[model samples]
Target chain A: MSSEIDIKYVADLARLDLSAEQAEKLQQELGRVVEYIAELGEVDVTGVEPTAHAAQLTNVWRQDEAKSSFPREVMLANAPGIVHGDLIKVPRVLPSEEE
Target chain B: MDLKKSTIHALSRNLKDGVFSSEELCREYLKNIDNRDSEIGAFLEIDRENMLNAAKAADIRRQNGQALGDFDGIPIAVKDNICVRGERCSCASKLLEPVKSPYDATAVELLKKQGFIPFGRLNMDEFAMGSSCENSAFKQTKNPLDTSRVPGGSSGGSAACIAADFAPAALGSDTGGSIRQPAAFCGVVGVKPTYGRVSRYGLVAFASSLDQIGPLCNDAEDAGIILDAISGFDPHDSTTLPDPAGGYADAARKGAASGSLTGLKFGLPKEYFSGGLSDAVAKVMDETIAKIKALGGEIVEVSLPHTKYAVAVYYIIATAEASANLARFDGIRYGSRQEANGLVDTYYKSRGAGFGDEVKRRILLGTYVLSSGYYDAYYLRAQRVRTLISRDFEEAFKQCDLLLTPVTPQVAFKFNEKSDSLQMYLSDIFTIALNLSGHCGISIPAGIDEATKMPVAAQLMAPALGEKVMLEAAAAFMK
Candidate 1:
């Protein structure tokens, strides 16, 4: 019912560096898109069951088996930046709350 | 032996008859890429040595009287997202620029086995995200038909290369009309086969359920030939269907002979013809339906009332999948990593710098949808809408053998016209419904829109695993 959205909050969530100009522009566009989406609320879906896939497939899977993987050297050779023992180094992170 | 302007079907016939050697055909297309790729920006990488070597082997097989599969010598350009051993399979993104495929995608293996020489990897939108090829990190591919405009993307390079006569046929993955939309924009034939009809083992995943690898070629018959070579059940791809009917070329040939749409029903979804469709496109669609009717077919109006929600539903599902799929691309695994004080910074910096803006947008959107507190409301609800969209098609197919619609609302828009990303996303509206339904579809250049002189595509969609029927209809239309 309300057409208000926090432009800066959404942009921050998206990791986009929106300038004042872009934020204003996006505010309008995003509002329209969201409004259009909200229109789906008008459809009465009381009795309908949610469908996850279009095709009727269940437990479609391949058996787990040992298969050859690319050689460690070849695999690491394609890495953008690699270090000792075929390991690729990157920035470390703080543990999450669950961790 | 030059494959310029030659279809895969024609080249296969010539090769079988010994009209030219495989090596000769491979060399000519390689030379064409060398001569024109600078301006056209088609190929991301050309494997000259391996291609010629493969072509030579095909020649030796011919000399030894060893039977080879159809199109033994014809060369094909593969979209960079599909893997080729030791070739840079970048997916047109800087994040994956330094990576080379350790193994071949199953489709590439099948293509090699069939005696078709590998052309090279063509450009695409970064991570196959954009509608126009402009998003490719390497370079923008100019439309071969009209150099000033974009070749439709994220398969723009594939379509442009074929249109420019660089490669007779090409492989492209469609998720939200990546293959068909570009094909229409560039005036080529592109098919998005039924899900599981072709294996997706080596294709860089964008949206797993929606992504399907298919052919982009100069004509529908050539597309069928390429599909025949690449499609089959693969143990590596759990989604692939186990069936002998994957031989689309033979099915198409047989279908053309005996199959007629004489009594078949076709639905033209009312929503597809509504607002935002250009007059030029509308006129061409009318003419195409007239042609189909002239061929003793019937057309009927149908309702896909959920059509307007397709773009939104597609973005939600596809981006959510993309968010999950692209998590594998973190710098630690195989891509460019930036150093930060800690792991969180590493992820933030690596992805922020490595990924393009559009990709970041989708990733963020996806992350939001799948995040805690929002999952049930956004992700769950979108799934239900997706079901409704698919059900609409299922109900419609009960009446119509195929559904016809415009591939895009308009012809190829100029690079400047789509500055707003939402506008660009709207281009996939016509194609996304087919993807959501998990059905087989193709876009054949119906005719040029008389108003703007740009090409318009007639989309043909059939039930799941109905590539044979779709191709049959397309070939019939071509004839």
Candidate 2:
């Protein structure tokens, strides 16, 4: 079973802020899922390479030429905040001390 | 003319023969949606005026003797996860409630190239996380066949629309049986082409390696037509294979016309027919096998030994990819946003509020599995086992042209029937392996479950890019 601290750590890594209640609830639920998935340990996978993709695809490259993209106005249409009629504005990135 | 019951090919023939204009067909479908959609809740958004205008354009083109193709005027529903320009591409989540797509997905673009109208955005499980459409932050899409039960999901609304006759056909993405399971439940034909057979450029990412876009239609021939229209290599999606020859529709037609499966060999995996299958579904399977034998197809017992481990590997790999793919929705770029004192807090609050319980649980599981120290034991191990599971298919196909199995252990359950997450995950046991192996699979309605009277379906899985033979067999089975 996942401890509360473990669940908190996972939530933090996922960038999800869970309340005490949510974390506690998730701990139990995730514990069950993990336990069920633990059955994979029984399979002996000696020297077998992992299959990351269903279809084998190597490096795919496209021409590095400028082409049409979504217009500036259209691209930023869904932005929560916009500045200077183009730039997407977000909250401060750096800490107060860095600023 | 019962437009709802008619197939896309039949409707196209009617349009060509001047039985009715494309505008008339659109109005009939619109009226059907108007009268029935409120109860079925299959559509998330429908633009009647836009649809009619497109239909009028189709009519004008026909009058000018420049019809695009057979499907020129066909109205099709698109699963919400697929982008349709200028329409709400919510994926049935509050996070994308305010977001509208700026461009059509590659599949939608292809459909438009064939003069097909993108009629409406259908609902799905938020980010395609849940087995049932109940995870939608919006309304729950009930089974059109039985309003009290679920429409099997995350492509629930896609399947529901076809079943309810709201559209002649629809497009749905399958990561872990999202298309086939719902198609089985709704008693329609659904196909999940081999991974990379269709471009995933515009599909909202959900397990990138496993995700595929395919069609849900009235029959195997319609599936062939839609697949031909939407499939081809795209520079946009690097994973897509170069366009194969365009004979899938012809293959289906030939198979249906042949009236015999004389030389076909079908494998029945003993693992699939074993325990945990409900008696009702098993009885249906026996009858289906008998029917297949009568059709002159030979049945052979084959073994996919690692079948039991599919669900475990699928959840790990799918969730791990989902955690990374979904990280892009951090509030600043698009979709619904929540403000906070700092950027970190902004991400936390927005994601926490935006994601539903099922999505949150998966993110947490994904994060836990992929985190440092546990990566080798969990994610890497699951990948290796995924390799073994895939190899199982590779070996099984050598013995037969295709394999037949039940799509789900049983028919669609009542709403909230299996609330436990593991139980819900286990329902996908048979279907997930195909996604993991990167093979194509189709689900066609086999018969009705005598006990519940819900739809029961049988699935046929083929080797990678084996769509031609698979569709032929499916068309034969349909006949």
Candidate 3:
């Protein structure tokens, strides 16, 4: 797991621009967290079912359909910066964005 | 008529009886907040105009004999993560800087319908991510009891505001102790209802499975009233239990005088006291146990063998779920969008710039755990351990009516004490197990630690939907 993780790789995947300082700090922190989690390697789970939630719950979902939504103006009014009519615009995506 | 130190139940009763007006309560609390919030940083935003209008409307309803709910004319505070219509719900993160909720969260709607005049959003750890409120991107919420220490968090603001008497009652979400832990720290009562008991609709998702909205307040009875008002099955959240809603407030009020610890078997998990606990905490807890025993409660030592794995298991599952839940926040929908010419840049710039450090760390860890090669080894294994954790509780409950544990190992720490991520994670050890077990948990101020003079919380846990029994036990402790 420690092939000296490429900062650019994670940054690209996360859509973040890491200042060299922040990257250095994150690289250490992330590496430590991953290594600590790797300690879970010692636990043995041969046949246990993976429980998604603690509750003995299943098939909890709302029907798919349009329900109540907030007023359009109120929703759009909150945009720090917005566009004409229906869209809230933003900057174009960069090519090096994560997959 | 100081609203800061009063209970919601008291304030509401007074308002109904004309002992005081709703407008007066609102004005008093708003003034208190205005006076103190700047230094304590407990509030994210306070809407003076909206708050006044709501209070005035509540007053009119009262005059017309049209009080909406028991909480009408009461000022309530909410954690930042819960949505309030047309109001900014930042979740204590810069990512949602200017983000406003188009609709109110179900809990918020319930409060409004009950005639609760919403005051303002409280601060919390960014995206409900940390144990100490320090992780909030905007500002840190300090403990009202001791300013140097943290207000237990990610509901720190909720707890602190209530503790400082800025709000009579506040709503907080508990995912691995967010509500209860802070309640303990701030010397208030915090309840995390049984999983599926409360609707999660409109709550900003944290760890979806662990997250449940509950109340933090001055007394268990008030917590009960708030819980009764906001709880029940919601079509918006299918995870809500199908059981009928009952009056938790009535249970609390009735139990206050009659509830006895007599014949109640309290489960004491050996794991909770083994090590890592402070001496002062252990002493206070044992003394409290003695007090309960004197009151006729029986203590039985029980073992949750899988307790050791709870922290490890929780992080994997919570972070994995969080990774998925937070994915929707990528700039295109409601928040800031970082710009680039292509699609990738947009996603990258928005998330990269939008999310804070702690959030990024979780996303990265979540992605890694759920990544292809590690999915079976990490994520799958964590789930299996989660099952074992739940089993431990099930087994313990068979011998005891309720389980007792410390809310956290120590009192609230200094803001900078937990710079290391692992250290911060460890602080959640006692609280996370319940989240994994999915039981109802509540924290009440046990007493102050003699040395540090900070509050130590006594946690009470009951079997699923055993909120009545839980309240009974907490009421006994308070008495």
lDDT per residue for candidate 1 within B1-479, as digits (tens), equals: 45556888788777788888888887787777778878888887788888888888888888888848767767888999999887888898888888888998999889888877666889999999999998888788988766778998899988998888888888999999999999999888999988888999999999998899999997767778878878878888777877664567766675566545576677898889888888888888889899889877899998898888888888888988998898787677787777766766666667767788678667766766676666766677888888888889888888889999999888888766788778788778899988888998999989987666778899999988788778888877876
In model 3 chain A, where is the ten-residue run with the lowest total lDDT?
A1-10
Task: Residues B1-479, candidate 2: write the lDDT tens digits.
Answer: 68665798889999999999999999999888999999999999998888999999999999999988877888999999999998889888888888999999999999999999987989899999877899999998999888999999989999999999999999999999999999999999999999999989889998999999999989888999988888888999999987574578888998899867889999999999998988878988999999999999999999999999999999999999999998998898998778998899999999989888889999888888999888998999999999999999999999999999999998898898988998999999989999999999999999998778898999999998999999999998888
Q: In what order do the candidates fall by TM-score, top score first? A: 2, 3, 1
Pick by TM-score: which candidate is best? 2
Evaluated at residue B334, the lDDT of candidate 2 is 94
Which pairs of residues have clashing backbones in candidate 2? none
User: Individual DockQ of the candidates?
Assistant: 0.38, 0.79, 0.50
RMSD of 1: 3.2
Chain A TM-score, cand. 3: 0.72
Better of 1 and 2 by DockQ: 2
Interface RMSD of each: 3.1, 1.2, 2.6
Best by DockQ: 2
Off by over 4 Å in 3: A1-8, A61-74, A78-84, A90-99
Task: List the candidate 2 regions with Cα displacement exceeding 4 Å.
Answer: A1-5, A95-99, B243-245
lDDT of 3 by residue, A43-81 (tens): 677777778876676877766897777667776776545
Q: Flag regions of model 1 displaced more than 4 Å.
A: A1-35, A61-64, A81-83, A90-99, B1-4, B255-260
